[model samples]
Target chain A: MTTVFKRPESLKDTETHYCSGCGHGIVHRLIAEVVDELGIRERVVGIAPVGCAVLAYEYFNFDVSEAAHGRAPAVATGMKRARPDLIVFAYQGDGDLAAIGMAEIIHAANRGEHITVFFVNNAVYGMTGGQMAPTTMLGQKTETTPRGRNALGEGAPIRVAELLAQFDGVKFVERCTVSKPRNVLKARAAVKTALSLQIEGKGFGFVEILSPCPTYWGLQPRVAMRMIEERMEEIFPLGRIKEPAAEG
Target chain B: MAEKHLMCGNEALSEAAVAAGCRCYFGYPITPQNEVTAYMSRRMPEVGGQFVQSESELAAINMVFGAAVVGARAITTSSSPGISLMQEGISYIAANELPAVIVNVMRGGPGLGNIGPSQADYFQATRGGGHGDYRTIVLTPASVQEIVDHVILAFDLADRYRNPVLILIDGVLGQMVEPVEIAPPPAADLPAKDWALTGCKGRPPNKSRSLILGENELLEMNRRLQEKYRAIEAAEARHEAVDAADAEILLVAYGSPARTCRSVVRKYRERGYRIGLFRPVTAWPFPSAALAECAKGASAVLVVEMSAGQLVEDVRLTLGPAANVLLLGKPGGEVIQAGELEAEIDRIIGLHKMKRR
Candidate 1:
């Protein structure tokens, strides 16, 4: 008998506090697997943002620092600049990245800070009870948007990956999902690629993961996953929006 | 001993921070303190240190937070409005117990007031401007030399207590040029940063966090912080007294006003008047007990400030009617003139005489 399947060594054995069907747990496992595979668990410093994944410090066995809302990029910038030997990454939510933390994320990327960003776009504010987020779909009816998100009033959902891809500092920009097995594999690969780019001293690598917030979306876990496949994918197409330049 | 060099307050502070082992600086450009950012940008890279011109004061402080969490000596500088934006990050740094230095070259306040000198941020700096029941060790520097010395002290105190240290100065001190003898960094021994987020190599992962979601955990953390504050208060309350003994009248001030008050005291003493000056160095600890002790022999106490009576309240609380504690304020970028302070002291003495009669 061989031990084929088990928890990644980089992830803690304790159960996560994330809600069931939430994409954070799967994403956390994917990051942990990547960290373990790269053998950089001892050199990685993860920055947890002020969102549903705020308790990310508890799940990752590697060192983690908790940053204020929308300030993870700034924090990661500080960490990487201060200790260039360490691998720094920031885990941010849609509201954290596109809304409150807009200035921080943009400036960090524009400065070409050598760090990685894991942006989770779940459409709505899951931790704050289904409020209309910057990435919320136009027809999505959140608690704050009882009549659905009005594009004229609330504006269109921000395409973060595409917006960030335009920056010269950003070397790689990819949007992926974990709603299906194939998508999950793609997301895993995207995570690995982002980390590798950072490990190679490439300027700012960004991976936007379209996650599911079943608790806030007023749908079953499976239905929320299906929403990612059917609707969310239409707005946020899954693919690498930008890639690093080839070496000579 | 390093030869005396002519330098502004901001440049002196930046040079001193480098000497004090502050290997990282993250700051945004703000008026009256922009020189510090520029100085750090040029000097940090030369010293093999890192310097980043952050997007905003918000980003700068968070960057300091990140650097400090990894056991690096980090600092950020801003003026009044920029410091307001940094309060959120400052509170987080305080709660996480990270050692970092913050410099506030204060300008007039309430909104985009002016790029002039003002001590209006006294309350905001000393009274826990950000959320929570935490305190940052605040040191007010009066001159270019003091700014250099206090910055080195700020880093030491921040690391000694694992708390943020703030060096408060007004626009006058920040931009004024003077001959300052920069001392080498003090060889102060600091404890190991065992709690820093330096990765988990041979042991469990370390976490640098300020959030306490548990009800009981937060309360316990607050209690622990209170105890640490008490320890700091007991160990680090500093104030300067000039001819305080046998003085009939005492004038209390700090920072720029204290520098003016020193000259005022000298003039009064030359005229055979028993007038003295009390300057509190550590603004957060307030030096209440030391101030009250210095006020024991004085018949009247006059509080001079650049604000409309912020530090006077602390003085009144410390004295508690032991002496007549009067307030003389010049708010809205008005520099306190020595002649005006002298006239105010005369009026107070005349009133005391009337009461005696």
Candidate 2:
């Protein structure tokens, strides 16, 4: 019997520019798989932000547009409104989404633009050499926070999913990780829910994926995966923060 | 046979946009220019086009950005304060080289000035209104009919050069009713945009974007845009030289003030004064060449405007200081009446006759 695991057609065969053990590749593959399964490959437009996934358009076969740092939501808003028939998504890193683009994304969601957002939360700015992010966990060590993040000085990690869930225009909101197979499946489901909400014209949809950057974290791929499974999940927590309440 | 109907300048622009195949209008409510939004609200749905009243000017202009990327003939209209709020999105649209139409019904400014007409935004409109080195093709319409005619030309010029075109009208023109002959829509053989956000349907994918981050890359992008601007200036600089042929004195003005100057010219001509008018149609790549030509024989030039002589500086540059240029106008929401302008012209003419004789 042949194992049927394969790369999705929505992703090109080119190798990514990410460092070894960086979870960007996995997240990219997951998004590609979702795009493929939904059969919206040709009609999907992705916005690459100024973070680790800034060059994500290089890997995604569909049409892609690059956005200025922290302006992906505004750029995506423009794209979706101009081409309403296209499925639009923004792939952003933690720093890009939470730090600089906070106003843009919040305003976009508040306006209920019909677009899906795939936010990657790795707790650090990977491409810019591991700086602390808004989602950076307490006690996390980064170039900016060399002595580990302090709750008093640096503030606590932001729970974006929980925050976004409060907006009325948001149709779905969830947080998931890619460290384990089960978690990967849940992340895929979250992506599907977001896309489904967009297709139904319900409103804005967001899925934050807890990805790992082993090279930036100074760990091996397996070790990073283990850290995510053992510690990251405990802090980030999994499950849908907002979904339509089922009728009793 | 063309049909003439009485309409406000704002309504004329809306009709002209529809005739020009504009498919989307996104704007917020503001005074003096409310007619453009209201007209679009009624007209857009009739043609299966999209019309949205955005929560704010920021969102409305961003919506214009979105619509423009998808190859839609999109536009937004606002007064000075609202236009200031839209500067960010306009810069983005300019950087991307997306074709869009923006109408600024000039009102008093620097803050929430008033609903009254003022040319205070001359610097903002002629110069790059937003950050970055970009120029919009600015057209000043002095008449309600030209408001219709120029808006149609604005859309054409916007797409022809793949840049934003501003129909810079004043509150008086936007609100005042005048008879206008609405021309038939342009010929059917007009070109189509394949790169617009009409969806990639049955075609190779298209990408519309403006994030040029790389230093060398952005430089090259701007260089290319500069080249386009140079070409646009070469081909599209237009102006009106009414009665300038044998005049020793020339009057320079634009927009509604230009109409007032025209009336001044008519009254002074009847009084045996050899005065002429030079009206700039393209305010940005301004009608400098024509003004220079008209200034050759004139002993002096006067710029009449609703603001503090913004275009007078341009006249000085065009005339090279050989011609004595004077500015007669009011600022802060004051309209220069035709009688005031005529008195100034007569006094200048009388002074010139005394010196020559």
- Relative to the real complex, the DockQ score for model 2 comes to 0.36
Clashing pairs in model 2? B70-B196, B70-B197, B71-B196, B71-B197
lDDT of 1 by residue, B121-233 (tens): 98888888999999999998888998988999999999999999999999999999999988777589989899887778898999888778886999999999999999999
Maximum-DockQ candidate: 1
Chain B TM, per prediction: 0.97, 0.95
lDDT by residue for model 2 over A1-248, one digit each (tens)?
A: 99688889888889988888888888899888988898888778887888878777678877776666677776677667656788888888888889987877787888888888889998888888889999888998999999999999899999888888898988788989988888898888888888877776778999999888897788899899898878777888888888854434
Worst 10 residues of 2 chain B by lDDT: B196-205
TM-score, prediction 1:
0.98
- iRMS of each prediction: 0.7, 3.2
Local distance difference test, per candidate? 0.91, 0.83
Q: Which stretches of model 2 miss by more than 4 angstroms?
A: A1-3, A15-21, A50-52, A67-82, A93-104, A123-158, A213-236, A244-248, B1-5, B181-184, B188-191, B197-204, B212-216, B354-357
Give the per-residue lDDT of model 1 (tens digit) for A43-91.
Answer: 9999998889999999999999999999999999889988888999999
